[model samples]
Target: MLPLSPAPAWAVAGAARVRPGDAAWPSAARWQQLGEQVGGRLIRVQSPLVACRSEPASAACAQLFKAVKNPYFIGDDVALTQTLGWVDAWTSMPSAYAVAARHTSDVVAAVNFAREHRLRLVVKGGGHSYQGTSSAPDSLLVWTRAMNAITLHEAFVAEGCAGQAAPQRAVTVEAGAMWSQVYDAVTTQAGGYVQGGGCMTVGVAGLVQSGGFGSFSKRYGLASGSLLQAEVVTADGQVRIANACTNPELFWGLKGGGGGSLGVVIRLTLRVHELPEDFGAVNFNIKATSPAAFRRLIGRVLDFCSQALIDPHWGEQIRFRRDNTVQVSMVFQGLTRSEAVAVWQPLRDALAREPGDFVVDSSPLSIVSTSARDFWAPTLVKRVLGFIRRDERPGAPRTNVFWPGDQGQAGQVLHGFESAWLPAALLQPNRRDALGDALFAATRHWPVALHFNKGLAGAPAEAIAAARDTAMNPAVLDAFALAILGTQGQPGYPGVAGREPDVALARQQAQALGRAMAELRRLVPDAGAYVSESNYFQPDWQRAFWGANYPRLQAAKRRYDPDGLFFVHHGVGSEDWSADGFSPRT
Candidate 1:
């Protein structure tokens, strides 16, 4: 490599990253040297959809759109994320260059290069961030997609915890590995379970860092809580092992402290659990004939939930729609189909008695149970039912499958997305009516989906205890559910003629979702929002996302990455930098 260039005058005056056009930007020779250091894994990033700009009618353009709908294809590409962009917030912008890291050393090289050059740095593992943290323009990306590897242990202990901690069955997952792969290995093949994101294609590392949740979280806990150890490459380009008995504070910070803020995690070891015998679901919709009937229905539903479903057995969502419909899509574990039916019998009977006010779907309510191990087994699930969509691309892995419900999020252009954790106190008999009214009014502005599993209330004691130890907001321990209101359009990217995002519709939907969230916030005046799926323009994000834990997380950031080499939107220690994370706030 040639000798380094002189520092730009602007950089000498104040702190700012070296942009592509800056005088201090790395030379082509320098980039090539860094690439060679990583074994030629560096990629000159480019979106496949860029070709559509000049040749809209070409066959290649058609193929690109088709592939955009398949999340597996999106996950495999370093230039794309499951969410293409958020309206008026950000669009997926590929970095100037990316190191497709196949080993921890590659990540160290990329980090050292970024720091030495004073360049903006970004990290991507799952590339599924709705907040657009994984994609940034004019930056160097540490792409860990090629580093995926999974290893299981019958009895494992942290590196420095031989005497301090007991041996437990765990799974060691590489940064690039997805939840689908972990599920297949731990659940389907080994007859065990791993707490992870419900989205099968979501990267394991990102999920754990952002306080992951899943269908069985009520029984298990947040994925962050299950993390036993992690190997991270920090800003100093040093590979550090973090666990309970070693670098314990960094380990806590890595748990629910938000990804891309602390460091690039190369690998993780998560404690796994014994598999349950059965997994079951309940699905149905009820339509009310009048506004008064809808209010009554809401109250009755809340009452029923408080009476029966406030336990570790149930998870998933219950949606309240603008069309006066209540959609129930809930799952259960460790329960027989008959037992599950019996638990819901009273609610069914109450709705039936009010035939004049409410009408249930003609298709009878579905309450079915299946073997727990087959839940994530792609081949077995395909043989038993059409519950998943497989990656049909040539030579795709047989395990590359996602739930049909998650299809719309792949490469989606987001209009609006907002969520608030609803405290379990709202379920009290005295407060249930007010909570019902708030939910009803919120639906008038937009639909709201209450994801029960996202909150830790009503969970097992062990689950709650584990979650409390992480850096996540304490509000989650008492939150009964996370109320979410979001809207989106089809896969579209910016600067693509005739395929650009519909800004007008997006703004309108965003306002509606905001109003819907406002109504719910009236009841829980100080609700905390999940960091991964929160408002892009949240004013007091530090408090809303991490609550009292913000100061501690900031301290950890200063300890590990005091120079702020790692930057993501709203991440810890980000308040000292510019919005783009390229310049110091001063």
Candidate 2:
């Protein structure tokens, strides 16, 4: 990639770097040379398309694309696209847009090119978005596959004493770094860690922006709730810190407003939790079907959460196994298995007393694993996806889509869910099962996972304890927040009356769903809906998952990104955003 020459890392990392030797600043010749010479070593996965390139019209674009290899470069492609896992959708964009960025200057150059050309910009790392937001047609995407740096300072780990969880050092990460990287860095490097926060492969920028939820969430808080600071690149081209002291409002917006609607985020600093010196856990299972069993277990699932234990350690999720059995998973955060057992013993006996007696068939099941990874190897999914192909897939049901960063809902998913304890008022229980069915149908093509965090139930609600349940980040995909929208209060289902299914039923349903969620704040008293998967909800989803923070998020958007350049569906879709701000051409 170099022009028969490569520069040293010092030359690249120096405080001031200028394109040398009269080489084209962003040319294939100079970019490749600079990329190769950049000192920070990286293991890249190149885009498959890079191998089949038309010689760059310009030596600059050509050399720049050539220097990085597919495996070394992460691109947008079938092997990289999640869910459908087909090449057609994958091939539309360079699959595997991974680049080994040596320093900030490189990113600056790439970003400038994208802006000059006015191309849709998608920043990808693990390429795990549910809606394929990281990839788009003809998009000038920056795959942060190489900026996987994590600097952990253990001084932030929180030691829980006297019911108060304290803080420790911080972990600063490049946008490309995966949650798994941060987890490992903090857990192994600091000798302690935060148990649950997000999916292992998710990139930090998007997750934190969308108010990430996780296993340790119930005990400590949501991913964004742990955010200490961030280094964000504004649309106008500036890398500024957004945290408590610097642009605090912007800091708050960055933490929970959801991502993509905003500009590129380069780095993030988050607070980590200190695990008990002897941290350990156990899991239990039961055939989760049959109405009575479902009601009993589902009820206690909330009660167990609502009822404060001697120590705060109770969690639950009812998963419908491919085998048709519902896996009632009980996660407890404790120092020792013995200690965990003491807390879970009652939960186990109670769940055993009932079951998943769902409309679907059922069989009791049980398995205990130490970590969520032992139970599910999310990383292995990538390996399994290689067998799939483009021609082998089906087309989309609808061409249009939404990502729920709307009406201020973004911050909840990104920050508020973890910031404070939402009262039971935020959730309405009776309509939940219906929403589950809706979501199950919506994502029937892909795996549909529903968590057990109920904001409606008191005491130990699921939202209070289900941290580190790294299954889904709905905000990354759809523009809707599921339960928080209006459907909760709609007529029919539970306390409501009837649902007209035919004529423009989609819109009606949307409105109804929006209405229900808007009513949730009344139920929890001071609590807001604990937003988890925002794909099904948004700031406009009044009938869905409503909360108290939506207005503040709206106000912030008005003050910043008023032009709507950084706006997304519900996240920053302030009522004031101009309709002409964006075009649907992309």
Candidate 3:
């Protein structure tokens, strides 16, 4: 774990930003002029779910409720976000108006308008933010849903780096492009790989800026580390090119400094890699009969990870459940099916020796591998593999598909979410038993998932080196895995009658999730969390999210957006304003 510096007292309080009822708010003529500047793309935003509240028994209301279940549908809507809300935390709320940005010029116009008018500004692409950072009521929104475009280059170099940097195969992704679209274009069609978020509908710009991790991140490192250049519109409405050679400090801050902070990224260029030979997944479950057996099971699993699975070939998660079961949903790269099975043989044998204490729950261990290129091929996934769920709405693109495992997150209300990086030292022979005990105790409260790919330890030296340069907490470079505990309710938003979230149950589960993470904190008290996945109410957010890198990121934030024209909850320089981002401190 990295040591944290004291929180800075730099931000000063000031007056609130302008809102709907303010006398200085934009008039109808001003809005019309701005709309004309953007080619009439302005939108007066309102949630389509409002119909459900008005006509409870209408057929259209029923269809609308079912459509919210589709992530792509939610992403396409201008007013809705992928997550509905969090109990006593935040709910999805639409901005008063939005500029449906179709190009960089549109984004620039929106930024200028918001800054000049002192309007609360929000940016939304895929709208997958679990913390409700993308949606703000009574604000002006820069909606990038129409800006999605993907282009591949056989050899590309950042501007002003022709002599210093070598050309590499790369892909330029627009702010609104989803991982599903990028995967289809780069890997399925071009036969090359680009690291990105595992979820299909997550936006490229948001994920890259938030230190993205995918199933193959152990081999390729973070998606942000692969960023070569970005076209961004800053607070002053200047479209600047940021890369290793130009605006280098801003480039570093953009990589894992957390999205919607430094500037509005219009597009990004990321290096691509040669496709691996194979991609595969291994899944199974084990149930222990008693507490002692569960502890022993955890120990065996840790030993297996330390011995073999920690390497670059493996990734994904292992879940320790309160039901005395451990669920394995691990993925692998560059390995054939037989090779993957052989790798797990030792654990299988170890479990066989403990028949009296453990049982193979229902399904036996299943290992399957496929040609790497077929992993994201739309046709193959839809017809042959059947591992992904497609957006079945009429006229939806074939590439719009998501993993079945991610279905629970689409439009769901979060209860609580917390993450902590577990350093490799805990996996040592001397401390492994204590780690096992902590895992058991944590499961007594709520399920704990260890996401191996989210951390860089045990990865290739080059992968670790690349990740170290990013603004993500340096602790990730040494942590073997990221332990996460999260709870959520069904697919529903607040204020929707008959479809409202169960607040009582959500609060109850949230407390249990908090207790579960507290158990892990006892082992690594000062562990830094991944910025995009940490607690929404983190007290020392700057230290917890960026660690020693916070000061550097703050410097860049000051240089580019000194007046703080943009605001997201707990984002950089957010301390200068009220929680809603409408009022500055006095």
Task: Give per-candidate clash totals.
Answer: 0, 128, 4
TM-score of every candidate relative to the true structure: 0.97, 0.57, 0.97
Query: Which scores higher on lDDT, 1 or 2?
Result: 1
Model 3: CA > 4 A from native: 1-15, 361-365, 380-385
Clash list (residue pairs), candidate 3: 13-585, 14-584, 14-585, 17-582
lDDT of 1: 0.89
Compared to the true structure, candidate 1 yields what TM-score?
A: 0.97
Looking at model 1, the pairs that clash are none
Segments of candidate 1 deviating more than 4 angstroms? 1-13, 362-365, 380-384
Candidate 3: worst-modelled 10 consecutive residues by lDDT:
1-10
Q: Estimate, for each residue in 1-586, the C-alpha lDDT of model 1 and write its tens digit.
A: 1122233343346778999999999999999999899999999998787758887767887788878999989988888888999998888888999999998889999999999999999998889898899999999999998888999999999999998888999999999998988999999889999999988989999999999999989889999999999999999999999999999989999999999899999999999898999988898899999988998999988988888787889999999999999999999998999999999888888788889999986454378788899887766545456676788889988778888899899989999888899899999988999999999999999999999999988999999999999999889998888988899999887767778889999999899988988898898877899999888887688888888888888878878987889999989877777888899765
* lDDT (10s digit) by residue, model 2, range 1-586: 0011222232234212112232322445533553554443222334333333433244543443332212212222322432211111122234222334546665555555445433334566655453345555433455566677888775643222223434556778888765655665666445546433434545667777767655444455456666766776665556667766566677777665656655667788776555544423333444545434443444454455434431235444444332333444445554455665555567666554543353322222232234432222222332253211111124521111111111111101111111113323222356444434433332222222334322113212333333212111212121111132221111111111122112244345444433333333333223223333443323333212233344555555555544333433344442232222224211
325-419 per-residue lDDT for model 3 (tens digits): 99999999988889998998888877878799988743443787778888876555444546777888899998898888887888788999999
RMSD of candidate 2 to the truth, in angstroms, is 14.6
Worst 10 contiguous positions by lDDT, candidate 2: 410-419
Cα-based lDDT at residue 38, candidate 3 = 97
